[model samples]
Target: MDKSAQTRRNRRQSATFFTLGLIFIVGLVVMLSNVYQLDGLTDTVHDRHAIRQNTRLRSLQQFQAAGGRGVVGEARTRSVCIFARDGPAILHVKAVFERLGYDIRATKDDDWDVLWSLKSPYVAFGERLSKLKPHQKVNHWPGLGSVTSKSDLATSKLLSAPVGYRLPKETDAFRAATKANPDKMWVVKSGTHRGVRVRKQVDNVLKIRHDANLFIQEFISNPFLIDGRKFDIGVYTVITSIDPLRVYTYEEEILLRFCSLPYHPFDEAEVNKYVVTADYTPTWEIPSLVEAYNNFQYSHKQALNLHLGRQGHNPKPMWQAISDSIREVMHAKEDGIREIVRKRFSHQNFFELVRFDFIIDEKLKVYLLEVNMSPNLSSGHFAPNKWLYEQIVYNTLKLVGLASATAAHPADVSKDERDMLVSLRDIQVASDRCASAECDDNCKPDICQLCQLCRTPYFTDSVKAAFLEHVNRGNYRRVIPKPLEEQPSTVDVSKAINSTQNNHLMTMWFRGKCEHDKTWCT
Candidate 1:
């Protein structure tokens, strides 16, 4: 009677077991689907993060290349070669590059192609500043330097000359004329207005053309007096970048160069007996000094007239001179020069730093002197002083993004705290004197004691002569000469120390202009 009931119960139990197995299988499929989706999401996030990091790295590299990093100590991307002979300019760049942790390769090669090929930022022209017209452009900073270009010559009569006639190789006649009329005012026709100390030669004129590879300028009469010694101003400026180039006169130094021999005052009896009595202006009357100078030049021939009243004005004093407006003008001009250089050359590796040299006449007229790409940068030279080198390091670091004011001591001070400190300093000093109150003035400021302006300074030749004499006396000193590769074995000292074979190192005749002469390099 119970057989049918037992069979139905067994079937029921089997059905329940099968139903539980199906539910379990469905749950397992759902869990596997969720796991796969999660894995895909994780991979997508990782790829996005990788892309972001790559973009960030590229951006940082770009900033470094553009000198946009705001760090104080860092490294540069490549080595830079400074092609200079002497002075502080080269040292400053070298020191700064080292401080910034860069791998530097210094060279004195006049071949710019080698420099460019080596992947340098740009070669610094470390000489005097040259004046450029408002519309003119330069490769780097123009007023602080000059770049070689056919276009810069369109308006520059001095730059536009016969290929072989740029700067005349000889100043013999001019020197003789100056010696003949020791006190006469003369025209120095070369790169810029230097100053007149002798009369212009009527027949044996020294005409400076563009291809002479020399710096030529007109030498105006400097009649100002300071303690009875003649002096000139050494204005310091810098051009940071060429593409959007900038120029600035961060410092000025005055040089009081007394004549090698001083003159005695004429006696009263001597003055009364002369047909052409000398009219001397007292040092106090600055304007009268100019008038007296002009009066003396009136009747005499060009050479004699120029030298007429220079005797009384001989012993001038050292004085730094520049207006605040001029400083600003110089800075603006620097930017203009950079923009112009970029537009003109369209080559990124043309030039960088330019130190423009200038000399002012008694009339306070500013005249361009010469343009230097490779300025002097030995320790004694002002350009490579410790302070300037520090700046170079700071800029290089900022470019590389390795160090910054924030990163250096970031843990010690909060960003707000650091900013507040800077803001407070800005308030205390004001914008004009923020760098330093004395710095804003025209005093002769230089790098170190070695470069301190001398009370009695020697001309370039004199310095070279004195240095050579010192060297001949068994003195061991570093002297920059033409690269050993360029000079003959007799002129090169690389093989030996104090080699007698290279005793008389030949100096560039007129300065570094011959080296910069475009045709010569070609």
Candidate 2:
């Protein structure tokens, strides 16, 4: 080979090597730019995700602050405090604690996990449900509500009770009634219609009013009869929440309290029979079969059925009528109830027991005669044999949780499933709730047996919105005020209460008042 040919070959090889090196450098720069763009996109997405998580966490924080039990786990604390003294209502609740193995005491202890307020309000952290020694109100009527006082009657006006007037704290009831209506057959009661005395004479009204709260209402003469006997029924309701007053009436567990005497109004001998009470026993010296049947130690339902069928009227539909009345009365006072309870505690964990006494007329129309706050829950009245008040204790005990559920969000739980409020009947679905949890020896049982339930979501956007949403769900019936729509003739608030007017107001008392236009709670 010649020298010139060798030099040309070297040049060609160098040129080819230079071209390859430039291409490699250009490709490396393009790859680095792509990598930088990818990182920038990832950071944008991560920052947005972080913002969303923080927003959700803030929302959850607000919900937990308002009386909501957030993120309640399966295990419940076994200890509780009985924030009540020795009484039928307190004693009955204590019995339930004893049976359930909950460490219950007359006074609350720091180590105790749950606070049983009985017929009272819930005490918050560092406070007590009952302080010092046990205190008992001789008269549960003051706060529990009464049928005998003017203020109470006004509050109960929402209940749409029979047209009645109160004698004030100690005003002559008989005189007042006689003064109100000289010709009407008004029944005067010290506290309730049961303890009432009906007379055409207008004497001694002042003494009765001075003795206690007095009320005078034209007597419900046409009461449903069981073989011509007058009787009243007892209903049990539980208050799970107060601010958003959530009440549940026991449909299955109820009692029928029958009057010992037959329904004979004018006869002085049978007038006592016209009055029904739990402790009343017939003058067994002339004890009739109904009295014998009542005294013979019968099952609650049996006694009720006998009393109900003695007159041969189906108790089922009659019961539905009674339920409507009870619900109507409670619905009327829901806001007031919330206000009353909120004055003490707004925590959703609060609960209470209320007893309602009702009497039904011959037309199957029910009248809400009276209400008992922390009513007589003596086992002897219907216990060991009757399940009316006992079940109220049972279900309430079953629902109240001792463990404080820590409120958590995606920031804490990393996108966990939402917590839920469940009913005892729906406890069978416990497995689904604990699917993510370590369902070991202890956790599985309570996952079903004990779950908190309320009207609103355990989680919500704002505390106020969530809390208000809670009360709205407490509606016994969503009586949406539709002024523009057709109105039901039976639900007139302004009209004087008459048997012909269905004897009830289906909406809140202030609603449906046609001071001008005949409609109103939109």
Candidate 3:
């Protein structure tokens, strides 16, 4: 009886152990399956997330490539190389680029989207310009001396500039002109010496070294005064293209420099009475402008406009005349600019910023005095000018596509979003024009050559560049290629024979665009 009981107990113990093992194995299998399922779910989420991220990046790239019209996403940080030495003059430029989220590279670094040099780099860094990618930009044009050079400008005979003659070369002419009008006050200016000396007597004119690079011109005796102080207006001008010759002037505010001394009593000896040197009087110091500028916080242009308006002078006509004069001067010097641009590998890589100084007569007539290349951007002389100079740089960069309000995009992104000038041969409109009854595919006739069908790639690219500029220009106003409706009555189209064929075409294109959409005019 004891042997049977022991065998039964052993069987019961074995059966219990076997049941426990089976339950433990089942629980382990279920747990492993749940873990695998969780891992698979995470993998799916990761794949979905990657797909979404890639799609977004692709869309952003496409948007940027298509001229950056809409909202932007995360963009690769671009680099700016300030080629000039670090100084107060370029501090605002660097700060603005930094504010726009650009990586400021050392001056020695060649890998940069922008190269901002203090002077024209055509002679020094020209080889770099040839190797520049479409996205690269340099802040200077090649032959800017044509207008900036005092001697060249004086000899240009531009209607806007005062009557002048070059020294040594035109010495006889200058002597005869001064002799003809002995009573008229003449001034002698040289490239090396920025200051001018009024010469009432011919002896002072003869004293000037004949070999020196000098210019002599009739001085504006009756200068328009504010509180008996003489002043000159400095208009910031930007030239974006040379082939079609696009010119823009900062319309927001102009740099107003007033003489420290009074203009009355006819003091030829006191240079401060006639010239606006670096230490010239500030707008805050001028009685008539101080109230509007200091108290009311009015801009220099606004305060000047107000003062002029109150004195029975409308600033609109004066500004328009100034704009016209700018256009005429550019037109007069277009050939020289084009000649220099023709030698460049890519003209699109270069742009220019200059200051056009003009003096106003008592009758509100504007006269172009001189053009300053690499004009001072520093506000060390006047603290209030910091804002104005910074804004000018920001706007100029925006206008030239160096900086953007939104995410940074390639500076060379074609703004021809409408593709108006893109691949004329592939466009249906261009195709139709080529196949017109009066035209052949070759477009042999001059009239047919001007059509889109036969337009050269250079002209097409120039038009595209111009259209892009027009889109990006914020406060800058286009002065050249004036719209037909807005053209002053004094401008004679027939007399503008020096204008290039491309310029004429651009004028027509802009005129047509403005007619169809008034926004293009602006």
Candidate 4:
């Protein structure tokens, strides 16, 4: 009886132990398998991140290599011809170009890569500009005078510009405007001369000579003042293309020219109280901006924004308004500008640098006063402004493809340059395709007008330009062909077909680039 009972008890214990061991083995195998799967997933994510980083790095290298080749292509030595008569005013221009390793040539030097002239070269160098090579560039665009000239600007009647009338032709309109708003003061200015005089009485304007080539504009009496002094912002604007119309402003800093006298106790006779002449007050001279600009080393724009912020004003909207105003003026005048450019041998060889003088009212509303062609680049009047002028020139050159990130000349470019270089051919091969699955490679159908394959050379060039600019735009912000967020959600096919608005292509390209690299968003 004892032997039988003992055997049963042993069997029961053995079976129980065997079952527990099996369960433990299975749990261990599952835990190990899960750990392996987790590590594999992590490795896959890391590999993807590395690939993206490599792709971006490669893309940047390609852009840098392309920059090494001057915009006009592989040139051993780049030369800039200066036609500016204002000697000291353009010293910074020469200095910056020299810093970029450009040889400064006299106006007579016909062999030049860039023609940095005070006015449209079409007047004196018409034949040369008409024969402009693909690699050549000019600082002025034809027909820009329509908006730059005081009388022409008044006649253009740009919405951003103050109410204005060209003399003689619109004298009657000026009289009516004055009668309607008698309290508003007006400033009479010569089309060619920078001199401006406030005209309080309508009789004074009427008494002026009819053929004086003068432009009468409403005076912005209630100016937004800093330290009780009136001021105007000199925004350095650049136009790279005219057909599609690309415009940019130097966003890093702006030139702040404050009136020599306070704006209060208005005096029509005192020119210093209103006009920001060549002898205008500098930023360091303004009490509110002195500390930030001089001691804190804040840029003029930063200092101005800080001051405005402290005064309970949001500078963002003010700046955005300013940008919007600039875009509007360019868009409004594009047809005229394009018409002039079309007469040229090649529009691709031209670019422009102008200073848009803007005045702000007490309500922070921005008004375009004038567009100064070949803006004073010298800091001869204000020594501290030398840095600002140089930077503006340098950044402008970079943005326009006249300057490269590296100082190496084309001949000195490394043998490995091709590896890093992304040529136009490469871009075309990679990007020139229809996104629609149903479309053939040629994109021959009429509906394929928007396709990259069917896009005109102008459209393609615009996209290429936009890509290069996004890469090299250090502190400049593109205003025309507005930022993607500000554009309509859908492309305007009609505009694209007409090539009047290729901004959709640029916006799409920029959006993709921005997704890959946030820095491009700027």
Predicted model with the maximum lDDT: 3
Tens digit of per-residue lDDT, candidate 1, span 1-522: 599999999999999999998889999999999899989989999999999878878865664555344333343243344444434435565565455444444554332211311112233433211322221122233333333232232114331121111234435544554576555443323332222123245233354333432333233445333334333332333332322221233221211122221122422223221111112221223333334324543211122223323533321111122322222233223344545554534322332333334444555434433333433333352221344335433442332222333423222233354344333222121223324545444324321111112112322222332232222212111122222222232222233221221122122211222334432111
Specify the highest-TM-score model's number: 3
TM-scores, all candidates, are: 0.34, 0.53, 0.85, 0.77
Q: After superposing candidate 2, which stretches have Cα over 4 Å from the reference?
A: 1-77, 84-92, 106-111, 117-155, 168-183, 192-195, 202-212, 265-271, 281-317, 340-344, 381-388, 399-522
The positional error of residue 328 in candidate 3, measured at the CA in angstroms, is 1.8
List model 2 lDDT by residue over 259-355, tens digit each. 7666665463455567776565422222333454457755444556555576666666655555455445544555555455445433443445566
Q: Give the poorly placed runs of model 4, Cα more than 4 Å off.
A: 1-75, 405-433, 441-450, 486-504, 511-521
lDDT for each of the candidates?
Answer: 0.33, 0.48, 0.80, 0.76
Could you give candidate 3's per-residue lDDT for residues 413-446 as a string of tens digits?
3445345433443222233444677776456754
Residue pairs of candidate 4 with colliding backbone atoms: 72-135
User: Rank by lDDT, descending?
Assistant: 3, 4, 2, 1
Can you tell me which runs of candidate 1 are displaced by over 4 Å?
A: 1-89, 106-184, 189-197, 206-218, 241-245, 251-351, 360-368, 380-522
